[model samples]
Target: MIKLQKNVDCVLFSVPPILLLGPHLAPALLKAYAEDKGFRVVCYDPSPGIYSRLNSKEQEGWPYNNFEEVFKDKALLLEEVNLWLDEVFKYNPKIIGLSTHAWASKFFIEPISNEIRRRAPGVQIITGGPVALDLGIEWKQNGWVDHYVVGDGEEAFLELLSGGTNHPNIDGKIPVPISQEAFRALPEPDFSDSDVEYYKQKAKGNRLYLIGSRGCVFNCSFCNVPAMTQKYRYKDGVEFAREIMNAQERYNTNYIELADSITNAAPNEFRKMCHELIRLKEEKQLDPKIICFFRIRRAQITQEEDFALAAKAGICRLKIGVESGSFDVREHIGKKETNDDIFFSLEMCKKYGIKVNLLLIAGYINETEEMFQENLEFLREIKRRELDEAIEMVVVNELYISRRTPVFDFAKDTGVFDNIDPEDDLARDAWQTQLSNGEMLDPKIRRQRVHSLKKFVSENFVHLKNLLVFAADEKFSAETGS
Candidate 1:
């Protein structure tokens, strides 16, 4: 493990308004990667510290989801950014890497990067993560960033630090996904540089985040995974299991959250990992439980035996993206799971005593009243089958039109986004969508459905909880003054 350095070669940062439970994983991974190559690297997550500085009244208005709120007033934003910069410049790192993965962090990148550039003229500013993968070219063209490392940042960043450039995955030229064999050989993320105790205190419990894989097996229309990652790749089962065990030993936490898009995307590897975890638990007398996002597939592929092994392996919870309850909507969105498949998945979870969290979208592009009713009925059936006991929560959100998604292209092709500028990258949240029946679905209808679903779930199920969240809600409220 690399200890904190007073004067480091690189200082990695995670921008503010990332009000998540655990610490960001990117900086820790980057720190480990950079230090392995003999570069002195220190990681900083000043988001919590920066957010705590705001007054109670100011905090109330600045919704946690909207990063733009922090940037609305340049003077106030600069004051906050400068306070953070003061801490970073103390290290006097030659290279500064900003983790621009979260979409909300996008708004902070410009203000934060500009300040870094102004304050430390000699420091090279590099940006990476999901945001960089999508809009690296724009950020580069704007001249705020010296370089951008898209896709996987570990190797690309190390190369940049070694004075190498013109690589396909660096300098905003293009992103090349790192191969699976390469991913398997990477070192464990060094959390020693992070305020681990602070994150543990803030989190629901003592928890750590890890990813066994990169990319998703299924390319859902509404998801940006395919474009972002290019291909599915996972660490070997034995290696990943050991990584989990090692993380638990170091972090002193049995609660692990898998950051992979889908935990069981590679069924064979997943089973192998579970088997290894089960073996390790028995041999070492260690009990480490995992919570991961899962994809429901055919029974033969994602069998009940898989869930059984997962339970024995100490997987306590599963967050499944059951995007819509309507079959047609699911199919259209590239999720091939039938109602039967969903029920079977839920049944297996129930059988294994694993808590389930269902993710739902309220207003898909073509979701009609009939389709929505089917969604409601799906919930009713869960209650009927007593699957609600296994379901801990259902999170519902309004459909977002993110750039580079298949849904976004479809919206552009249709008349829904006719009035919007083709070059407008900021207009990601659209309220209006033309239904299959030639009816326009507006924001009001979507909000109603979102609320309606929540109400139904709350009223009907005893154990099943529902949370309605959307990043666009704050922006819409500010615009309409509702």
Candidate 2:
């Protein structure tokens, strides 16, 4: 393996927010830096307690289901950070790169930043990722962080490491485009130095991490993808397939996670990649579990052939961003999906026997009780159609509205977001509260929205129970078939 620069060893630290998820983008950045710039990379994850609990749960036959469960373990969170600090001190890296993501940003970065600064005052502290972008201004104002990188960090990070320029001004503005060629040329992420088996064992055969594409084409108001990655770009399919095959071979594992913003944004390109995977499987070149994010637009998956191709490629799980059930809200959020489109797309996934995870954002600028009820009704309709068994519903409360997104503009125009604070604690708390309450325009309507949402969830508890049972049965069926 290639080593990094002699004088300035680089340590890549992923301060994952107590979440027992799969591999993150930090390792990929490490590999990119090492290959492209020859930086000696050491990866430290300060979340071992979380990993331990995850392993225990996996052994007990109940794997972690969501990011919340993994992050809520406070004890694990502390222990992991301590362990990570020890490892970092051993390396004594000249530069420390903190891998930031959206969910973990709220709780993880500040403490990690404080610890790093306290322990190693001389080391240059750099932060990157969507979370970094969202909170770059805040970090800049604080003295802990030396530099904050927005957008893709591969090229800019290397430039910084080479002493090409002083860290860019952290004005809380998004950075310009980094060349896609840099990402393509980046070496496969270096997880070999870390305890790969530990993470795999924790996964219990239900985890993988990947990145075939970066960014999204659509400008969804509430989403950060557009702001983070201004353009959509993809690695060549053959290259992606090789990466997957390599990871599977190295880890002795098959579960593959596509960490792309949208895996199937370009239909023809995606189909071609799927066909390549099928070919690889046929030639015994690869055998891997696959999960990917796909837009639920009917136009993307209109033909039966496309669905068949996707299945043949081993895409077993599809995460669709079905943001809302109401047409107006969908349009308002720039999703452009009608109710009919959602139903048709869902039915197609069911027909293909692919597990579907529906992602819903609860609150927006002008969300109404009627809109929330429409979503509940849609869920009921899905349950009635017996598609609930194939679908897992994930509703997330919004936080940290990006200043660049359409939602920010909407908030400003509608007077909902009068207080703009990149750092105020109370403002952040209010934002979370508004998100939980569905951001009802009128105070009276807020309760109704919450009540309707609660009612829908309560009414569908049996359906959810049955869906879980069905999922277990399906897993058994697949294992038996294998």
Candidate 3:
């Protein structure tokens, strides 16, 4: 342990819950690292503080799903911001770190950041988020942010806290990727600070939120994974399973959510993990339903192999990035899964009695009416063949470019974002392609199509319709005004 530059070493803040704060693995891992390094770290979540003001007879269920959207109202945001200001001011720390990943954080963190600057001018405010590396000097000079980190946050944050030099600032963004060995050396999460009961209540049970790994192997063109996690890294199945069992015991939950982009990024390791989990379940008489995001390929989903082992090991649902039905569009975006691959994987999931959530993206850069039609036909084929029966829910989203995705680069290279100049070059909102036919793709149409598909899947899929609530409660508080 070395003497710190300031009294309190680091205060990390998590803002904007996707849904009442399921365990945030990032902060936990980072906190564990700081403790191991002999640093005093305080993990703060502002949701409960923000929740107090919103209490009412009807609004007592205040921190509902998508509750962060309520902050869009300026007055409402200030109410929450004031609460955060009180807590942050109480700490009066020298270093304040904000984590931003979800789209809401772009706007949601602003007011709190503003209040941080106003109250403590001397405090160094750092941010790690999507597009942080690309933020211009003007944006970084806005008083709220002293330095923004890019790639993995742990090393960059530790370096900043230790008063060590970081990467040469690209417009004041300190871009650094932690070494894989260092990442592997991170201690088990220390969630001693967070609201465990709140997480359990939000999960409505003893739901275990565990991370199988970080980073992704594939470079899907429209994916933001590459910018966030620089390379592929994962823990083997046995390691992941032991962690899961330990988390289940810790949280007292049978439902396990592996919060990885692709939990089975490593094939053989995944099999070993699955085998160990199945054996553990049998030995301990445990019934765990594992849910995690996955990337589907024909090789991984064979009849007597990965899918079978995963299903036997309590892999209830696998969220697969189906992307688009059009082979042309998928190929265009560098997604290796073919139409045959999609159906084949679904068949395997069905045979093994494992539910799958098909994650579809609409409107590629070169998307045409025919491309969407191809996707439409794919959905039709699935329904016509009753393959939709195997699916839990089909989440179709209107494609929006995320900053630093390959698609965004293509749009940038084509001068679509030229009006914003080189400064805002990575802004996904600036991505718009002018077709050779002299017409831009209407986003409204794509959005409409996505909504229509969502409705259709909800109403039509036989088994899937019944399992919708278990997948995600989109209407948990739709009319409650909470």
TM-score of structure candidate 1: 0.92
* Local error of candidate 3 at residue 471 (angstroms): 20
Candidate number that wins on lDDT, 1 or 3? 1
Ranking by TM-score: 1, 3, 2
Looking at model 3, residue 353 earns an lDDT score of 90
Tens-digit lDDT track for model 2 on 7-32?
44677777565345555656565555
Candidate 3 lDDT by residue in tens digits, 1-482: 22223355777787654345465666777778877888877767776555545546424444333445555578877766777766655655778877665644566656777777777778877776554655424346775677777777677677787876455432244344556676666677777767677766644534556776777888888887876777776775677788777766666664788878788777777888889898888887777888888787765444357787899999999898888889888987888777887887888888889888777776667777777788888988888878886887666656666666897778778876666653442344334566666757655555556655666666667666332211111332211100
For lDDT, candidate 1 versus 2, the one ahead is 1
Candidate 3 RMSD to the real structure: 5.3
Instruction: Give the root-mean-square deviation of each candidate in angstroms.
Output: 3.5, 6.5, 5.3
Note the residue pairs that clash in candidate 2.
4-39, 4-40, 18-70, 254-289
Q: For residues 406-482, write the lDDT of model 1, one tens digit per residue.
A: 98888888867776664465554544877879777887788788777767776776776444355345332211100
